[model samples]
Target: MDVKYQVFISSTYNDLKEERQEVIKVVLQMGHIPVSMEFFSAADEDQWSLIKGLLDECDYYVVIIGGIYGSIEEKSGKSYTQLEYEYAVEKGIPVIGILNRDVNRLSAEKRERKKVNQEKLAGFSELVKRKMCQFWSTPSDLASNVATSLHKLMNKNPRLGWTRVLPKEHPIEEIVQTVNVDIPKPKNVVSNGILTERDIRKVLKKGLFDFGSFIDIYFIIEGLYSHSNTETKLPNSQLEWIRKNEIPAHLQQVKEIWTRSYRCIYTFINIRDLAQKRGVPQDVISIGNIFISYIYYVLTEVWGDVPYFNNKPELEMAPKGSSNVKEIRTLSLANLQSVLHDSTLSTQHVDLAVGVAVRWELQAKNYSKAKEYIDKLINRDRYKLAPVHEIFSTDVESIGYFDTDQEGSQFHNPVFRVLCKKGRFVHYLRYTEVLLMATEIYFHLSDHQKALYYINLVRIRNNQPQLKETGNNFIATLLDDWKANLGMEGSYFSALKRNGYAEKVLGIPAFKSVLPIPAQEIALNPNMQQNEGY
Candidate 1:
């Protein structure tokens, strides 16, 4: 497949506007996406989050330092340009730093006047020099140098750039048949006439199966989960959704089915009442509660403060009022706990409930509760760590693999390699994650020996040298291991945030920590409140 990389163009706006334009044009000529801060206002306190997210998505970062210090972020006391560069560096995005060969030759309008800014500019220039550096005297020189540097970078380290998936070849008759076929109405929707236990089972199976079929769910979750890893932070925008072309359509498909699935669950509740009247077992109703709790957790985590349908599934079409994220998570955990305790709960659901409980507790920062679920997962003998060699196997299920479709192509996790279309076996939970969580829990409780013991399990399993008990900076060592193991799997960034390394490691402001509710969501729902940060 032909790949088109996203190349971020970073520079002091006013001074290097011409240079940036040249670089953007070059990137376009190279058939790559050129991202910049043109659409964002640097004065905005939360712009860093958006900028950081943009950089995260970009395959290459091009930093052009002219004379100006650029717009400084008040919180970090660093220019947004510098912040962007540092974040890209922190995330290990390949950078092409171009500096003005002689800033003294620049016109008065292009040079920094403040002594402090000049000092900062000099320091920043030196910092960029530590990486891939190219000197330029003019916009054209900058463009030429950028083109050369980008070519070298592309040749040296190939990134998983974006590519359009073309339609597969089919027989002429197949094409004709497809063209003649009428579009089918959605399946798995709970109809208005589901009055029996059989009907409930049919709808539940069909609806949940249909809900699960949207490969888009994996994509959307991967994109949104970027917030947790140092990938994408803050609420996503219409632009972000558009930039990721597949997102909007899949998102719509998911929402449509997701809403229908909710309607089905509500339909199930009514059937439960009928079943109660008939003296039939309410096992399905209990099972439905497990799914509902999971649904609430997913919605709240992905989009904070979503419209929750509690007692009224009929209001599915009505405008949804926003529900508090904390409340939803708390309720999901409580419901999961209640469901897990039921005598009729099956072995399969017990596993599912424990997994959900672990995630919810982790989100809640209730490490103790998270540890309990994790312990149950460990002791149940339902899963075991794969041998070190099999951990990266595309077909292996021993270590971790959710939704392992035979048709689905797999790639190494981006953390270990370059970003690509088939980035890793997109997994939700892993045996290593469980071990790491145990490590974190023990570390939290000040049990150094236990923490080391748990963390070493992962390292030893992977055939890597283990961290010694005598090693200094155990937390740092553990953090490095956690990041390496889970990078790009949708958990590293959240891990950083949860472990208090986000502000320090991510270098983001405090307010940016909480994702801003996407503006489009608020616009669509007048009742939705924006998060604290813009």
Candidate 2:
């Protein structure tokens, strides 16, 4: 039998209205039907019954504890929210609690009530010996923790029963231990006495120079180079030989670098500074810088050109591609956009910047702005650039040029029509697609006029006739038409997400629509925060 799980939100209405809303938003984002008291009138007994039934039917329960507990008498003494939580626990449902850290600083009466609630919760935890509940300090934290917990719960087979149920004591540690089993070490370990060809082969076979292990290898090399023990030191001649020609020539030399140099073990910041002071070229530092920058561009959506090392200035620079640096002295949003619009600029360079800008705007939720840039690419007559698909999707291998009959298929004799005939220029993102995105954003923001305008613009560009309007219902009609025509082009997901229409159409929350922040960012910046419901 196959069944979808429901999540019921239990919270004190008086104290946690905002938090409850947040949780509901998260639930909706997660594609689950959220059951809460706000959906009903204050005095509706039928609503109360429905809520209880929802609680009973729900596969997971989220109990939000705020500053004050609602009076059972006011409807008051203990809250219906607390009672629902108790009921959920009694029914053996998976329950998680979100408690604000500020609860400790409440008024005396409220504090006393909070204490009682805390005692009751503690007693329940002790009695049940279940690690089902967790606390979060902030709304964002609550959302993230809930998402993570729910994801773990969902991935495990329910048939596994209580084994998958997390216990409260050292919960994170337990989760980690479960996920990563200890690998026993080999009894016969090799000492670092001699650099055997076999040892070199083993290390090289592991592809140990990738970004992940580069730092570890660098540190190991550094330890070998900077040995302080005179008894175990190599001669100056050997040290000089290693310094000049230690790293294998076959290793991929540094291609590009970013601003982050501290992470590179071979690139010592202080040593580089000293070298600069002595007016000497630091080849190792330069290589490390270029490699890191290339990695940064590949991993993150950073706007502007791929940074290059400027030998004269001795700094990483984003020089305008194939243009005189003196003429394009400064870089700004307008400058970048103008460069993208210019027909003279290399299409590859323009498209590179455009792609980065598109991603940046999408992340910042500036869909209209993103579309404007995209429009320039698709409507190349207005700007001198070629149509987006002509430039970006021109790769013969990508569209399978040789896979079909030469006379029957468009892919058979495909030719590059955008920017230049030479294979150097390619369009990364197109204008029509951006317009589609803008339309979706406008629809989501409930600005029907803008949505219709952008959608009709695309239709006109595609040689489609203007859609006929039937009074106020015209917008909905046009929306349906757009979906029918452009739905298969990857616009459906964005439209549903931006409009908050996913809950009704796909039975999922909008929170699930967003991508999570890179885990590395979280590790680096403790103050940096994750998105809600992610």
Candidate 3:
């Protein structure tokens, strides 16, 4: 079989962009794929997880060092390039290191100014020298050495690589191209041909739904056990098993799925203006805006500060910047808030904005603002609490094979239905959730009467007795209702965290409130800081 090896190029990005591109070209010219951090935003755990997955899959690893030592991760106190090299070594992957012969001889702009980074770079260079290494002084020379070194590495210890029985032919220019030139094509044009209105609509629809499909139900299922004293809580052993295996497996999957989903959204955004001009429905184009705002909200909520791409869709192709969580939240809020009074928006869109606004304001502890948004939803009279039986189900479609049974029968395992299954609508916002949100907001505002009134609506709908308590009694009643009604819907944990019950209920440390930025991410970006206690 004809095979092509995957070569992962590790280096500091800004200083070595051109040189990395040159090396990438040589790899491509030799008929192989080149993987690098240049195509990723490596500042979060998800990104780091994805990087490790790529490194695990690639056939060989290559490290190119320049004057700069690159970013250092706080946890390990080592640069990301060094971390990548070490990981490759630990994994027993073949490594080819290219070190600059003399940093002192390089231009001042290209040299490290900080005394600390200089020492670290010297040490790192020595470490690389201990392995199969080469010396390069310039980009062209580096590319030549990479081509020669990779050839030797492949011949010495060949591995199973990607192969196709019948590979599609490419044009001569595309095959021989050394650098990416953004030759501007028609706004509606794509790799194949003109992006027709049908194509635009189809992609937008997929982009809108694909994002919803990416929401893992495990997050919701895990939330049900987040609080203490739940009968359904997984045993410590099962929880450990999930943390060690399932979560990481899904995280890798989520990274891959979300990466493709973002590209789909980006494609729609890039051709949106043209699609609109081409007479695609306004509703179709509107999906792009709605998808982006909601995605930003979801991403920031999970990843703290993610790489912002909506404002600059081009960065999706070549990411080089970071976004603050708060700023992205503010933008998403503004985008949603702006469309509240939009005459053209559908009721579903309007309600989505209001419900999300309520959650956002609640997250910020602006209870009064949250109440205002919730009132817009409740006062409209279009929504009402549904019976618990109507809203939830006990149907078992497929059993999740979590074999806690020592004898191999998974009869006692918890069966979690796939949330991303076709035609299954994952509820992002629900009327009952909004009702409980109103209850909390009203309680915070010291309006016990309104709080009791809203909570009673859901309680009465579910054939449960109304809550007649005030003060802490009312707080307890409201929280119980939130868990009972919104259990496994992904909102209970947020409610616990929001109501200051996480520590008391979950018994986790305050530092565990936020997730840690992946060590590789911090190592890649010197300015990036890890979360507290990480």
Candidate 4:
């Protein structure tokens, strides 16, 4: 019932006949109606006129170019195909050209005919070069190329440029009023000495509190809360009772402590100094100490932590004690790591510290050590940490303590399963990953046999079935597969860096491979200097 398809085909009779036939067959295969003069015999003037009308009405025009020039009729002195192509161009219709190479490679007389044909086709080539017309070298390439181009063109969003245009009588004042607005200011204000509820809410909302403000507010609140005697001191409660009641409360407290700790550490240190000057409660000072210790552990593991505290003797004079109420200030990664690794550290405390370290190491791009610590923490049974995927999965039954679908459904979320739990620690590094890294190093060192052995070892674990033999090409393929599969697990970037491929693969400038002195650190200490590049 519907007149669905249409295309106009134009080509020289002598040279492009075969090519044009191929194109017509393809057009039919693509489910379009084709109109061409070649399909009809001579002496059909009525059919010829119908074909010309179809050519003008059809959706697309196809031009086939071959070696031989089309014949010049004795009286008209112009080829019908040439005239059709010119008309199509003049009408601003989309045209596809197929050039037949077999016809191009012909005898001298045929070549002369081709030269004449080209002269007729010269304007079309210019249009094709300018991207106004699409051209294909062969008939086979035509269908695929045209289909792909049309698909892409149809999928592209049409840009709106003239939607605002209207009759000259339209009111401009209404449009101007719709686009303008005035900024508003908050009504409540507080004095600088003490933070009011509104001031606290504002600071929290803006996320503008520095480390000093964090320490001040946290310590001040913690001091008042600790003295308030809100916690029910349960001396003889059973394990089950504690788990059902006291433990939940304890966990809430721990969460608050860690949240405050994180904010204090990340915001900068002048707040802690301010807290000390203001004579904040001892437990409040301990919170800042513990936060600093956690940060130091992460920095040390990743960047070969510098001993800034030891270098500054005045800072090392803080009290040293095991009580949570006292401020024990030791500034060194080694000290921080030692405290975290200590067996006597409470499970809750160690879990919080390890979680912070893992997060920091990952953020600092010290993934290797992060993996190592995560693996250690996960393997410990007392910690009750789960497997990475199990912890991160979106299946409601399997969602770990840290998993949240706030951003979207589980399927669309980007956070890894293992890292989902807020305080749940998991072992990240496996022996297989270490072996893979070693294999990559061996490959770089040109120890082909050793490299193949290690690569095949990992492949076997992955159930790949086959063992690769020693060779450059095999190693390259193994590396390619490794990068593809092991990527996002945090290996690809490190491998790129280790193998001198960071610049090539990541587009990282060569100077960025090494750590630079942070601008703030340099500003604080005149002795500090930046890395080679800013």
Top-scoring candidate (lDDT)? 3
**In model 1, where do residues sit more than 4 Å from their true spots?**
1-199, 210-283, 302-304, 313-321, 388-403, 406-426, 470-472
lDDT by residue for model 3 over 319-362, one digit each (tens)? 33457866777777776766675666677677777777777788
Ranking by TM-score: 3, 1, 4, 2
Score residue 156 of candidate 4 by CA lDDT: 51
- Who is ahead in TM-score, 1 or 3? 3
TM-score of each: 0.52, 0.28, 0.57, 0.29
Angstrom error of the Cα, residue 24, model 2: value is: 25
What lDDT tens digits, residue by residue, belong to model 2 across residues 420-517? 12233221223444565556556545677777777777666556776543355553554455454433222344444334454455444544343233
- Give a tens-digit lDDT track for model 1, residues 168-261: 3332223223221222233322245333455344434433443333223433343333432333532344324322322321123233434444
Error of 3 at 464 (Å): 2.6
All candidates' lDDT scores?
0.62, 0.42, 0.63, 0.42
Model 3: runs farther than 4 Å from truth?
A: 1-199, 217-281, 312-321, 392-425, 518-529
lDDT of 3 at 461: 86
Candidate 1 has a TM-score of 0.52
lDDT of 1: 0.62
lDDT per residue (tens digit) for residues 164-264 in model 4: 11112112222122221221133323354453433333322122222222332232222222121122432222221211221211122222333444344
